[model samples]
Target chain A: MEFWVNRDCFYKAISDVSRAVSAKTSIPILTGIQIIATEEKLTLVGSNSDIFIESNIPMTINNEKILDIFEPGSVIISAKYLIEIVKKLPNDVHVKMNGRQLVTIKSDDIITTLNGFQADDYPKLPRIDEDASVRLSNTELKELINQTTFAVSKNENKPVLTGVYLSFQEKQLTLAATNSHRLAIRKLFIEAYLDGACIVPGTSLNELSKLMQDESGHIHIYITESYITFKSVNMTLYSRLIEGNYPNVLGLLPKDAKTVITIKTSQLLKGIDRASLFAYEGKNNRINIEIEDGSKMRISSNSSEVGKIEELQNIKEINGQRDLNIAFDGRFLMDALKAIKEEEIQLSFGGSMRPVLIEPIGNPNYLHLISPVRTY
Target chain B: MEFWVNRDCFYKAISDVSRAVSAKTSIPILTGIQIIATEEKLTLVGSNSDIFIESNIPMTINNEKILDIFEPGSVIISAKYLIEIVKKLPNDVHVKMNGRQLVTIKSDDIITTLNGFQADDYPKLPRIDEDASVRLSNTELKELINQTTFAVSKNENKPVLTGVYLSFQEKQLTLAATNSHRLAIRKLFIEAYLDGACIVPGTSLNELSKLMQDESGHIHIYITESYITFKSVNMTLYSRLIEGNYPNVLGLLPKDAKTVITIKTSQLLKGIDRASLFAYEGKNNRINIEIEDGSKMRISSNSSEVGKIEELQNIKEINGQRDLNIAFDGRFLMDALKAIKEEEIQLSFGGSMRPVLIEPIGNPNYLHLISPVRTY
Candidate 1:
C-alpha cells in the first residue's frame, strides 16, 4: 500500500500484529503480516492457526496526522524483516507498493525494497457478529486472565484443558483454569449481560492481557462457536476456540474444611519459597504445612541429597479446633500468594492428602486449589 | 568449617566464586567451592579448568562483625547449591563440619546438611613468584579487557589466538587481540617495571573484568610461564596461560595513509547499526563506506532480497586528496566504536582493499584494524 506514516505509530502496529506471526509455520504466507491501507485507516494483521492479531492505525489521532494514504491497497510482507526495517528506519518513513508485490520503504537517506507476498494468498480474518458482545474494562479483564491463566495445562494431549473456561451469567463473569495438579478461579462483575460459556486458549488470553493497556476503557468481546474476538480502541485480536467440553472443576475444591488459617500472604510466600530450595532438589518440591493451636503454622521440607528447612510463620486468625498437616507443591502456593493483592490470605485445609483452597482474605471471588503431595 | 557469618557477606562470597564453578566439568570436586575458615578470615574458592576465583571474607569489616569463626577447618560444598542456599537463608547462618565430609548449615529455624567434598580432593591454587608482578588500577585493567577481548578468536584450531596478548614494557602495558579477520589493540601507561609478554585466555580475562567491579585501587598481577594471577584487596583470580607466540600486529597497521577521516564516534556507530539491519539479511552483513571531499561520508548497504539503506554523516576533518570506498563487517566496526571512549575517531585508509586502522582522534595507543571485503 502507498502510505507515509510516523515511525513510532507504524512500529507499534507492526510489533503488536507480529506477535501472532510464526516464522516456522508450514504455510509460508502465515509468516507474513498482511497490510491494508485504506482512506481512513491502515490495518495490519498477523495470524497463525490458533490466534490472529490485527491492529489499526487511524489516519488522524488527536487531530494529528499519523498516516497519509495516497492509494488504497493491500500487501503481505515478511513480519520479521518488516519489523527490523521499521525499527532501524530513522524518523518518518514513506512506503510505496509497486507492481509485482515490491514494497519500498524510504527514510532520511535510506531506501529499502522488500519482496512481499500477494495479498490474496493471506488468510482472511474471521467475521464476527458484533451484536453478540460483552463489554468489560481492560483492567478487569487483564486481572482475570492473570489470576487464572498460569494454572492452565500446557500439555496439548487434552487440548481442552489448555484453554481457560470463561463462563458468564447476568453481569458476572467467571474464569477458571486447571492442569489437574493445580487450579485457579476468578470472578468479576461486568456491565453487560452475557450468559454463555467459551473456552479461550490460555496463550491468546495472555496476549490479550498484555495488549489491553487502557484501564478506563471497556474492551468489547464477541464470541462465536469456533472463534472469539476482543476489540479495543485500535486493536482487534481473534482467536480460535478449543472444541471440547471443559471438565467440571467446581467439585475439586473442598466444600467443608477441617481447619482454616488466615496469615499474611508475603510471610507465607517467603517461607514456602525458602523451603522449596531444598525440596526442589528432590523428586518433587513438596513442602509440609502444619497448623498448631490454630494460630501457629510451621512449614518444612527436606531432601535426601540436600538438607532440610523448617520455618515458622504467624497466622492472624484461625477457625476450628482441629489441627491439620498438609503437603503441597511450593510453586503452587507461591503462585497463589503472588496473585493475591490483599495483605491477608485465608487457607482452608481439608486433610493431609487432599487439595487446599487458598483465597484472598474476605474475598471468595478468587480462589486457588493445590493438590497435596504425598511426602511420605 | 565452623563459623557464623552474616547472610550478606556469605552471599557475596558464594556468588563471586561461583562464577568459576561449572556443572558440566569432568572433575567432580571442581563443581564445588572450597571453603576454608580461619581465625581471621573465611576463604571460598571455585574453579573450572580454565580459571579459578577466590574471595575472602574477613572476620570484621568497618568495626562490624561479618564472620565469627568458632573452629578452623576446610570443606568443599557444591558452589551452585551453596550460593542458592545462602542467598535464601533467613538471617545469619551457622555453618559447621558435622562429620568427616558432612557440612551443616543452619539458619533461624532451617537446618540443611549437605555432603561435602574432602579438602584433599580439591586442586590446590597455583603458586607464582610475587617478584615478577605488575600493578595497575582495577579500572584500567577492566577497560583493557573490554576493549580487546571481544576480538579474540573463539575457534580452538588456533588455541593461541583465543587468548589476548598482553605485554608490559617500561611504563606501558599493551593488550592486543585478533580473530584473523579483525584486530583490536589497546595500551595504557602503568607505574610498573618492564615485563615479558603473556597470553591469557580471553574467556578468563572476561571473567576477571566482571569481578573487578567499580574499585579504583591498584591490582597486583603476577605472570608465569603457565599461569597468570590477578590479586585485588580480598580476591584473587588465577588463569592458565595459553602457550605459543602471538602474531606481529604492529606491521599490519599502515604507517602512511592516503586518506584519513575524523568523525563523531557515536554518529558513525548509529548510522552503521541502522545500515547493518538491511545488510544483515545478506550473507556477510557487509556495509559500504565512502568518504567524499574529506568532510562528508556516506554509509550504505543493500540486500538482494531486502531493500537498501544510505546515510550521509558529517565529518569534522579529512586529510589527503583521495576518495575511498570500502566494505567491511558492520558488527566489527560497532565493537571498535564501543571500545573507543573519545568523542572523535580517526580512520586511516591505506587502499580500497587494505585493512582500515581505527584509532582515537589524537591517541595512537589503541588501534583497531578491520579487513575490507572485496565486492565484485
Candidate 2:
C-alpha cells in the first residue's frame, strides 16, 4: 500500500487523535495509533480503554485535495514516534507499507522506516445504536461541559462523583457535578424529550470539549447500555459510562438565604484572589466574608506563621440581615466565579455554618453552592 | 521603621535578589531576605551561602521621589511570602515595623501583617577590596558567559570541571568550559593586566547572567582571595570561586585537520535536531556523519526496535579528504552550533578517532571542540 499526504494535514490529524493515546498501557497494541487509508478518506484512531478518539481527513476539503489514495490498507504505528517523525519532516510526506508491519515515510532528502504492528492487533471500537440519540448545538454542548465539570470529584474512591451527571427531561438538559464540598448545576433547552440520567466521566467530557470546534454545528449523541458516543464533523468520540448511581445534589442547596448582596464580579474575584495568598497557609484554606453597614463587604484571612489580609469591597445593594459573617474554602469561590459569565454576581448566605449560594445576577441558567467551614 | 515605596520598583528589586534565596538551608535566616532602610536608599539582600545578590532602590531618581522614608530601621522577612504579597498588592505599598519583629504592609483597602526577624540575625555580606579589578563592556561580558557556560560539566563528582575557568593575561580575558568530552573557549579584550585564573561555578554564572541587563555599560569586576564580585548599576553579585587546578585543554586540540567543510549554521542545526529523534533510542544518542562525493553529507541513525533515519544535507564547500566518516553525540553538536553566532560555520575533522573542531568562518572570538565516539 502506498499514499502521499500533505504534512500539515497529516500532522493535525495525528495530534487530534493522540489526546487519547496511552503511552504506558499493559497491552502493547494500545500504545499505537491505528491508521487506515481507503478510497474515500484517511482515518486515525487512538484509545486507552476509557475513551476512544477518531479523526478523519477527507480526500478533498473545500475543493482542495488534501489526501490522494492509490491503495487501501491499515497499519498500527507507535503514536509517540510517528508524531516526532512527522513534525520534523518537510512539507509533503510519502508513506508506503511493505508487507504488513514495515512502514516507510519519506520527505525531501530525509527518509524514515518504522516497524509497525498488524492492524488486527488493535481492539475493535464498540458500536452504539442510535435508538436513543439527541442532537445539540456545538456551543450549547461546550458551555454545558465547561460550567459543571470543574466541580467533579477528582478522587476516584467515589467513582460516581468523578463523572458529570446528565439528565434529560421535558425538553431540557440538566448537567450537575459535585464533590460533596461544592456543587455546580447548569440547564439548557434541547429539542428532545428523553427522560433519563447518565454519568459521563469528567475526563471524557474534558477531552470531548477539546476536540469540538467553537463554530456552529450539530453534535449527535448516541447512547448504549455501556458507552456514549458524540459525533461531530470529521470526528467521533466514545466514552464509557461510569457504572453506578449518581447522588442527588439538589437537596444539599439552601432553600432560603437570610442575607443577599449584589457586587461587581471582578472586584470580588480580585479581593478573594488576594485573600487566598494568606488563606493557603491556614488549616482549611478558608476566607471569611462579612457584610457591613448594609452597603459594604469585607474579605479577610489570617495565618499566625505567615500574615493576615483584609480587603473591604463596596457592594451595589444588600438586603435582610447585615453584618453576617461566613467562611469557606477560597479555591471553591474562585472556581465558581471563573465559570460565571455575568458582570454582576449575587452572593446569598443562609448563616455562618450553612451552605452559600452564588449565581449570576438575573441569570437562571447557572448555580454554584459551597458548604461553609465552621470557624469558632 | 515606616516607609512608602512604589510597588513595581520594590517588586523588581525583590525578584532580582530572590534568585539567591535558599528554601532548604540549615540556617533559617538564609531563607529570608534582609531589608535595610537608610535615609538615601532601600536595599534588599539574599544569599544561599555560596552566592549573594544585593539590589538597591534609591529614594530619588532624576529628581523624582520614589520613596518617602519617615523612619530608618531594618528587618528580615521571608522572601517566599513577601514576594507573593507584594505581587498582589496595588499601587504604592506602605510598610511599617512595630518594635522589632512585626511588619505591616498596606495598600488601598487591603492590609497584611507579617511576622519578621530582627535584622541583627541576618548574616553580613563580606567586603571585597577593589585593589585588583578589571572592567569590560556589558555586551562582551554577557557574550563571554553565554558561549562557555553551557559546556560546563553538570556532574559534581569532579567539582572543578563544573565551573567555568577564566584566565586574565596580556589584556585579554579567556573563558573556557568543558565536560571532558566537549570544550568551548572564548576570548575578549579587557582593561586590566592581572595575570591569573579563577574557576567560577557555572550555576552562579548562569544566575548572574540573568541579573545583568543587555544595555551597554561598564561592569566592574573585583576579585578577592576567595570570591569574585560583579558590580553593575544598582546590583552587586558575589560568587565563591571553585578551588582546584583546571587541566590544560589547549594540548587536546588537533594541530591540523584531514577534512574541512563549511556549511550554513542553521541548516546543520536543523539536520542534527531531526537526527536526534531516532538517535534518542540509540546508545549515547549517537549519529553518524560521512562526507560523500566531496559535497553531500549524510546524517543517519538506527534503532533495532524502532526504525532507521537517513538525511542528506548539502554543503557549501568541502576541502581536503573526499570521503570520511565520523560519529559523535548529536546533543554535543547541537549545543556547540547554538552558541556559534556566525552564519557560515567550518567543521574540521582530524581523523575518525581524533577530536573535531568547529569555528565560525570569519570570527576568531569563539571555538568549540568535541571528541568523536568509537563505534567499532
TM-score of each model, in listed order: 0.96, 0.97
Evaluated at residue A361, the lDDT of candidate 1 is: 80
Model 1 interface Cα RMSD in Å = 2.2
TM-score of chain A of 2: 0.97
lDDT of 1 by residue, B198-246 (tens): 8999999999988887567979999887999999998999999999989
Best by lDDT: 2
Worst lDDT 10-window in candidate 1 chain A? A209-218
- DockQ for all models: 0.61, 0.83
Candidate 2: residue B138 Cα off by (Å): 2.9
**lDDT of residue B31 for candidate 1:** 91
lDDT per residue for candidate 2 within B1-376, as digits (tens), equals 8899989989999999999998899998889999989998899999998999999999877888888888989999999989998998877999999995899999998998888988998878877887888988777888899999999999999999999999999999999999999999999877788888899999999998888864468788888878999988789899999999998977777889989999999998988888888888877788899997778999988888989888899999988998788899999999999988999999998888988899999998889999988776
Q: How do the residues A1-376 of candidate 2 rate in per-residue lDDT, one tens digit apiece?
A: 6788889989988988898998888988888889999988899999998899998889888998879888889999999999999998877898999985899999999989999989997888889797788999888899899999999999999999999999889998899999999999999888986888899999999998988854469899888888989988888899999999888787777788898888988889888999998889877789998886677898999998777889899999888788798899999999999888899998888888888899999889899999998787
What is the alpha-carbon interface RMSD for each candidate?
2.2, 0.9
Question: Candidate 1's error at A276, in angstroms?
Answer: 1.6
